[model samples]
Target: MHLAMIGVGYVGLVSGACFAEAGQTVICMDVDPQKIEGLRRGEIPIYEPGLEDFVRRNVAAGRLSFTTDLNDAVDRSQVIFICVGTPSREDGSADLHYVDEVARGIGRTMDAYKVIVNKSTVPVGTARRVRRLVSKELARRGLDLEFDVVSNPEFLREGSALHDFMQPDRTVVGVESAKARQLMAELYRYWTEKKFPLYFMDVASAEMTKYAANAFLATKITFMNEIANLCALSGANIDQVRVGIGSDSRIGDRFLFPGLGYGGSCFPKDVKALIYMGKTMGYNFNILEATNLVNQAQRHRFIFTIGSFFDHQLDGKTLALWGLAFKPNTDDIREAPALTVMERLLDLGADLRVYDPVAMLEVQKHYENYPYPERIVYAPTPEAALEGADALVINTEWDVFRQFDVSRLKNLLKAPVVFDGRNIYDPAQMKQAGIHYFYIGKPIY
Candidate 1:
C-alpha cells in the first residue's frame, strides 16, 4: 500500500510511522519546510513514547520517507490521508482554515482516482464540504477525476499513541463507495492480524464517534472530580470510593483517576467543539455542558485549596511544582491543569520551581511571556524542584513521582507540607515521613 500522509504533526507522524512499521510504503508530506527537513534528517519533532525508535527503524528499512512537496505525494500515492490539525476557534467550533487549505491543494494537485481519507478529528459533514470543494477545484481546472472522501477518525491517547495506533480499539472507516472501502481495507489489513476489528459506517457517524469518545472520557473525569470535591467536604476518601464504585462492573476505573483534570490535544477541545456543533443545530448538550463547567472549576478549586492551606499568604513563598504536561509520557501541555495552578499561584505572589521529565522546553516557551521570569525556575530533576520550597505539589501522575522516597523528601523541603493534586501518594506513607499530606477527596491531615 502506497499512502501519502499530509501534515507531519502529531497525528500525521504517528500514523505514518505506524503504517510504515506495518510494512506499507508511506510518504509523509508537510507544508513546513523546516519540519520536513527535520524529518528527512531522522529527527522527530514530538516527544511520544516509542515514536523515535519506530521512525528510526522504519526509515532505516527504507519503508518510510518524508517530503514537503504535497503535489508529488498526491501524484504518487493511491491514498492520501489528511492528518492536519483542527484547532478550536474562539467561538468554540473547530477552526478548519488549515484543513480547507489542504483540501484545496489536494484538489488542485490530485491526478487520478484517489481516496482522500479524513484522518484528522473534524466536525460532522466535513467530508461533504471537502467533497464539494474538491469537485469545485477540479471543475475550475477543467478536469473530471473520481475521488472518494473517507472519514477515518483517530482514537489515539497521547503517551500511549504507538500502542493505540498499533492495537486500535477498532478502526472506523466512513466511506460511500465499495471501491474506497476495499482500498482502505487493503491498506490496513496488517493491523487486523492481531484481530482488531474494522467498523464501516456513514460519514457523519464516523465524525461523531471521535467527539463522542473524547467527550465521554471528559465527562468521566469531571464526574470523578465532582465526587472527589464532595468527598473532601464530607471527610471521605475518594480512593476507596473509586474502588467501591469501579467494582460494580458498570463503572470502570480507567479514567477515574481523581487527577487535576483532563487535558492535552483531545478532551478539552473536542468536548467544547461537540457542544458548539450541537448548539449550531439548535440542540443543547446538557451533559457535556456540565462536564466542561465542572472540569474548569476543578482546576481553580485545586488552586484555591493550595492558597487556603497557606492562610492565603502565598506571597514570597517558593512552591515546588511537579508535572507540567497534562498527563505523562508526552511533552504536550495544552490546557494542562498544572499550568492553571502555576498561573494562579504566581498571581497570588508565590514563586515556583517546576520540573517535568519531558515538558521543560514547552513550559518555558509559555512562561517566557510572563513579566517576572525570575520568579519561575525550571529544575533539572524532581528533587531539584523540591529544594528551597515551602510545599511540594504533584499535578501530573507520572509513575516516577508515585515511587519517590518519602523520607528523603521530608529532609529536602523547607516545610513538610505536601499538596498532591493527582492523589498519587498514600496519605499514610506521607504522614509516616513526618509530612503533612493533602490529597483530593481525603481528610486533610
Candidate 2:
C-alpha cells in the first residue's frame, strides 16, 4: 500500500515509520521545509524512544520518505492520512484550523479514488466535515472523483509510542462504505497476524471513543489522587489503600499510584474538549469538571507540603528537583506537574537545581527567555543537582530517580530531607538511612 501522511509531527512520523516497517511505502509530508530537510538528513525532531532507529532503518530500506509537497504525495499514493494536530482553543474546543487546511489541501490535490483517513484526534463530526470540504473542492474543479473519508484515531502514549503502535490494545476504525473498509483492512492486515482486535464502527462512535478513553483514564487518575488526599488527612496510607482496591478484578492496578497529576498533550486537552462537547449538547459533565479541578489542585497541594515542611521559609533556599518532562522516557513537557512545582517554588523566591535524563535541554530552551533565568540551574547529574541543596524533590518517577542510593543523600545535601511527589521511594528505607521523607497520602517520617 502507498500512503501519504500529512503533517509529520509526532503522530504522522511515528505512524509512517511503523507503516514503512510493516512493508508499506509511506511518504511523510509537512509544510515546514526545514523539518522535512532535517528528516531527509536523518535528523529526528522529537525525542521518542526507538523512533530514530525505526525511521533510519525504514528510510534506508526505501520504504519511507519525507517531502514537503503534499500534491506530489497525494498524486502518488492511494491512501491519504490527515495526521495534523488539534490543539485546544481558549473556548476548550479543539482548534481544527490545521486539520481543516490539510483536508482542503487533500481535496485540491488528490487526482484519483483515494481513501482519506483521519488519523488525528478530532471532534465527532470532523469526518463528515472533511468529506464535505473535499466534495466542495472536487465540485469546484468539475471533476467527479470517488473518495471515502474514514475516521481512524490514534491511541499512543508518548514515551512508549513505538511499542503502543506496534502492539496496540485495539484498533478502532470508522467507515461508511465497503470500499473504505476493505482498504483499511488491507492497510492494517499485519496487526491481525498478532491477533490484536480490530473494531469497525460508525464515524461518530470512533471519534467519541478516543475522547472517552482519554477522559476516563484522566478521571481514574484524579479519583486516586482524591483518595490519596483523603488518606493523608485521615492518617491512612494510600499505598495500602491503592493495593487493596486495585487487587479487585473490577479495578485493576493502573493509573492508581498517587502522583503530582496528569499532563502531556492528550489527557488535559481531551478532558476539556469532552467537557465543552457536553456543554454544547446542553448537558453538564460534572465528573470531568471535578476531575480537571482535582488534577490542578494536586500540584498546588504538593508544593504546600514542601513549604509547610520548611516552616514557610522557602525564600533563598536551594532545592534539588528531579524530572522535567510530564512523564518519564519522553521529553514532552506540556502542562508537566514538575514545571508547576518549579514555578511555585521560584515564585516563593527559592533557587532550583533541576535534572532530567532527557528533558533538561528542552526545559532550558523553553525557559531561556524568562526574566529570572539565572535562578534556575541545570544539573548534569542527579547527584550534582543534590549538591549544596537544602532538600531533594522527586516529581517524575524515572528509573534513575527510583533506583538512587538513599544513603548517598547524607553526604551530598546540607540536610537529608526528601519530598517525593511520585511516591517512588520506600518510607522505611529512608527512615533507616536517617533521612526525613515526605510523600503523598502518607504521614511524614
Q: List, residue by residue over 1-445, the lDDT tens digit for candidate 1.
A: 8899999988999999999999998999998999989988988898999999999999999989999898999988999999999988898899888889888999998979999999999999999989988998999999999999999999887899999999999999999999999998888789777799999999999999999988998999999988998888887888889998988777876888786888887888899899999999999999999998988988888888899988999998999999999898989999898989999999999999999999999999998789999999999999999999999999998888988988898889999989899988888888889998888787543
The local distance difference test score of each candidate is 0.91, 0.93
- The local lDDT score (0 to 100) that residue 155 gets in candidate 1 is 87
lDDT of 2 by residue, 268-304 (tens): 9999999999999998999999999999999999999
CA deviation > 4 Å runs, candidate 1:
none
Pull out the clashing pairs in model 1.
none
Q: Would you estimate the TM-scores of all the predictions? A: 0.98, 0.98
Question: Which stretch of 10 consecutive residues in model 1 shows the poorest summed lDDT?
Answer: 436-445
